[model samples]
Target: MEPVSPDRVSDAPDDRFDQSVEALIFASDVPLRDEDVARAIGEVTGADTTLEDIVAAVERLNAAYRATGRAFRVEQWGGGYRLATIPEQAGVVRALFEQEAEKRLSRSLLETLAVIAYKQPVTKPEIEHVRGVGADYALRQLMERGFVDVVGRADAIGRPLLYGTTDRFLDQFGLGDLSDLPTPREVEEILADPRFSRERAQLLAEWAADNQPPPPPADSSEPVGTRLRVVVSSDSPPTPSEADDADG
Candidate 1:
């Protein structure tokens, strides 16, 4: 004879409630919307469950997991809630599999990304306008790396696709938002590093001297290392060597 079992009407479903919910949240890749949770609950119980109850359940799970110091927790992402590790634990996670973080983005990619970051939602043509060269390869590279995405179609004559940065782009660049990026002056300074070779620094220094006001007399000295921005013509492309040196 089969062993006696717990009552079917009450015990089993109650015991499995949290486990089923956990599984549902865990298995989902994108965040699960609140309505999706309600539908799942209704399917399991054969009765509609309110969105409020699902939220309450999720809140309880979040609280319990917080107290437990679990490796992962439920997070809101992509407009839905899903389980994810705290970002601070990234090093631990990566080390568990013995991986080194990848190299920084190439100079061309960084410049291209920077242009898009400032001008989006912009089309490739617009990016080339500011960059003064075709941006096709850089755009393809950014898309492949998940740094940029097709955000919309441009309103121009041909309706080219518009591009914008992904959330991953922000994470990779350590920026809180697009507004956190350095200004043109800062970018110029960064590109003027001595490691770029003496000729490059001289060019930047000459450019700076030509554009900036003369130093004030000793009593009213200007701030050190501040440089004025020289506007470049949108029609003329930067020379490939200057771009390569700047990239360096």
Candidate 2:
């Protein structure tokens, strides 16, 4: 009799192989490809697990999740199986992750990332030149977070490292590809809009004013009121009484 092929093996009635596949998928941080799952299971069980068997196991696991009303289900993405929260449970999942979102990249880091995303494969100097600020800290933070990576070295005199967004960046931003990123024209239009620009400027101005160093403590020799008068005078045209006092 001919030996049965691994592809012909059936994973029915919740067998050990099926359970192992489920556990692997659950434990994986990123998606697990069928071949990867099959190879891993074959090593542990010393059995010839095939891609077909791994796929069948995933199907069964998803069925079990659905039947048991589990909030998450395994789905194929980026050529592998990953557990994703079901649409019906998205609200609760988002609420749970909102706290984590609070710890997300700051505006400065985001600005630096946007520059790299749009201008890659670009260099750190290019990013800094566009943003008019040093990008060393933001680039380091992005690299630490796995959102950006050094793709290659530029062919310039100094041969600076070329940076680019990573797959994690696309996944984190819910983009299927870099092409899904917003176009430069779209961003330019948004910035050119008077309403949006005015609001942004106002918010920035308010934030700057709020964070300004408390008026350098009034000189010990000057009264607080006199210092306030000086500040007010500098900020606007002095009233006739103030002008006359100044002249006197």
Candidate 3:
């Protein structure tokens, strides 16, 4: 959802409810779900707080912020509420994060993360099959980053462990939930948009088209490792030659 604009909203009456909600969200170390907000408010006032009340209260708070030209707004993300600086504040806010840019996740890890997020409860082999590359290193990195988790085991043969996205993943991407993720149809629509650049559009299109795993030399049931050549990208596990050099 887009942040509220200062020019778009009229002045709202200042009220205690908006104040309490604002204070709670602003003070939170993490996003607070509506129920969490309601419970916290109810505990303070000794009154029943409903989910609808909490939602409306936040909307009113944002309206007040818009009318007052506040640089930030209370945003709903990861199925919860958190304060975020408006786009107009991006210049200075971005400067604060620029130095840490090199620490960002690599493309391979992002691709693996995307697969897991879209097809959660999927197994390592399944992820490997989709990407035509090893996912062990990427999975480990994602786990360490708190974005992925071992949800359970696949009910298939050998009961391979199943992986799924964590709430941290939703928060990192500013998604309210899995349902907010863009579908394949949406991606195609984006690629087809008239405003899209032709060159980059073709690159993405080619990548998507060529991402299919190679056919098995024998049967499709052959092991994924045998069916595809291993790649050593910036994020993939090191090859034997590279590992040997590192040891030396």
Better of 2 and 3 by TM-score: 3
- Rate residue 144 of model 1 by lDDT: 98
- Per-model TM-score, in order, reads 0.51, 0.53, 0.69
lDDT of 1 by residue, 5-104 (tens): 3354435553356565677888887567777876887787776667665665566567667667777776655446678787789888878978788467
TM-score of predicted structure 3: 0.69
- In model 3, the Cα lDDT at residue 12 comes to 51
Rate residue 52 of model 1 by lDDT.
Answer: 64
* Alpha-carbon lDDT of model 3: 0.81
Residue runs of model 2 more than 4 Å from their true location after superposition? 1-24, 34-69, 75-80, 86-101, 180-188, 191-248
lDDT (tens digit, per residue) of candidate 3 on 7-125:
53234533577778889999997988988888888898887778777777788778768878999888888789999999888778878878644357799999999999999989999
Comparing 1 and 2 on TM-score, the stronger one: 2
Worst 10 residues of 1 by lDDT: 1-10
Q: Candidate 1, clashing residue pairs?
A: none
Off by over 4 Å in 3: 1-14, 94-104, 186-197, 200-248
List CA RMSD, all candidates: 14.3, 11.1, 14.2
